[model samples]
Target: MSILNHRTVVLDPQFKDLEEFMLSIPALFTENKGVVIHKGRNELRRIEYKGVEYVVKAFHRPNIINRFVYGVFRPSKAKRSYHYANIYREIGVGTPTPVGYMNIRKGLLFDRSYYVTLTSTCPYRYEDLFTHDFPYAEEVLRAIGRTTAVLHEHGYAHKDYGRANILFQQLEDGSIKLEIVDLNRMAVGPIDMKAGCKNFERLPATPEMHRLMAEEYAKARGFDAQKCFELMQAYRSVQPGKIDGLY
Candidate 1:
């Protein structure tokens, strides 16, 4: 951990060698030196340092109340994201390798923050399955379902489970490797059938796709396939308008 001028930074031990580059993120971000990947409530950029590719997420500055909350009582989103990424790795879940996180403070309150991770090599996101005629769509969806089941079984529920957050690639052995990103809002605890089914609400999938994934998820969790499908459909039905790439 490094602290200077009301800014605190914590790096994963494995990435200690990149401390200098990590420390320079605030300046680099302010300079707008990286290629922008997404721009919205928050911003993500792909940057290179010493020929190494990294994705840096600059979180929006919190509101006054939230600044105090995040500064004193709660972890900033960047910190949570870094923490959860390590937890995912520990539990054998796929996520981009966390490099570090930095939190800037304004007086007694939190200001902006950034989270850094190595760029993921996966070429396909879950949205591709819907937009394009992705090869082996059924098999990939099944793998996604199984991976989600594993995630839930390990007591983690992605609060923002959406198509864009899921990245997948096919391996040589015909298995799909799925990696999840944007990890700040995750619920960690025993997940019941209802919560598990509701987790699918944000994924934009056709009814048939939902059924396929539901059945596969049910098989992995040993739940009744029909019940799982129905519950997932019910939850998906009431989901609010698309929010931040979710649908």
Candidate 2:
């Protein structure tokens, strides 16, 4: 039930004159020794070049339909991830700052996926900081709750709202900065309290942890606990059977 209050428009392929972007690579990865920061089955890679970080998201799809869908309907979650993060940042929240990124390409030959601006400092995921104490944990959660409220208030819905989509950043003072990632399936529509509530409901719902998260979120966002309770209960009534291959 994600709403798309804002339509994240991606750069059209027609506007991509590859020759112009490729020219900048010579001073980065080519002459410098960049190390891998992160890697995934998504074929997305983050590399450090010339003391700066860059994310390169690659896709291996020869299917024309895949290309068409990627180009139009479902834009790169990579870029959307940044856009949402920036939205959070502008509102006194902590999100990874995006510099700018090149559209994923293999030199001047073919285009693959979109590369997002990389963060040299943020944690890969919230789980990445399980061992360490994130000082701004409460602030981070409030920030998250506020972000969720903001999205709903703005008429946006996210395709994935699980734990993985929520990432943590360890600032210089050891404070945790929360950020959302993996955008691409956001939608635009009038707010349906049900859909937004279902997103929070479909979360892990740990016996203790989720209860605490809900309480914290309620307190942080100044949302009524009873409202969230009704929403969760209503959403649970129409639960689906099973969804496999959801990684």
Candidate 3:
């Protein structure tokens, strides 16, 4: 049998016992019997541990060539997700609370990895709000705009700031809270006004919605509204493609 190497980091003290369960990530992923949240490049599952629900994202095993490349050149996605979640929290940005992460390797080759986070009850995403009529839609859109602007002000760029990755929760106090997900592609660096405006390239917003977002974003960042809107438009025009029927 090939030697397996495993390492884990648990962020929650209450979930200390979960650390021991990290050893079973490989088996849990292989069993393939959980509420599948996502099933693309990586697989996400909602699992219950002692009645507490959590989401476990299992990244695809690398190919032969990728095994060597990942082992030598970079940290696993699980590691990046864990660290980024912490960074977002530190910056006052919202994301699902990270529970832990695990990296599995066979001999010297990178094999599989998993990222676990607490399950949240955010049933609405920016996608839903954009595509359907909802109460206080304008307020929510402006809030999203402000949130994105604040994210940029903090020098964080979400590589995939698509609507689906931005989740929303309506609190009992009648306020909305937004959380960003799919964080492995995020980066932290100094962001200029133009670059920050370009970050909206993937959002599916109508021209009127774009105008509102641009106004709010510019106001928050103290940029010229027209200039910011133009910059957003320029970047959006060059997007690989748009999601049809979303605007």
Best by lDDT: 1
lDDT of 1 by residue, 25-108 (tens): 889978999899999999999999889899999999889999889888999999999999988998888999899999888777
The TM-score of predicted model 3 comes to 0.90
Deviation (Å) of 67 in candidate 1: 1.2
For model 2, the stretches where C-alpha displacement exceeds 4 angstroms are 1-41, 68-94, 101-111, 128-139, 169-176, 211-223, 230-247
Any runs in candidate 1 off by more than 4 Å, and if so which? Answer: 1-4, 240-247
Q: Predicted candidate 1: what Cα RMSD to the true structure?
A: 3.5
Could you arrange the candidates by lDDT from highest to lowest?
1, 3, 2
Residue runs of model 3 more than 4 Å from their true location after superposition: 1-4, 7-10, 240-247
Tens digit per residue, CA lDDT, model 2, 135-178: 66555654555567666666665556766667766567865566
What TM-score, computed on C-alpha atoms, does each candidate reach?
0.92, 0.62, 0.90
lDDT of 3: 0.80
Q: CA lDDT, every prediction? A: 0.87, 0.51, 0.80
Reference-based lDDT, residue 234, model 3: 71
lDDT of 2 at 20: 40
Candidate 3 residue-wise lDDT, 1-247, digit = tens:
3456645455567667887667676677678756888899888899876788888988898899888777778888888888888888888888999888887777778888888899977888888975677877787778878988888898888888887898887788988788888888775777777778778888877777788888999999998989888877777778534222221
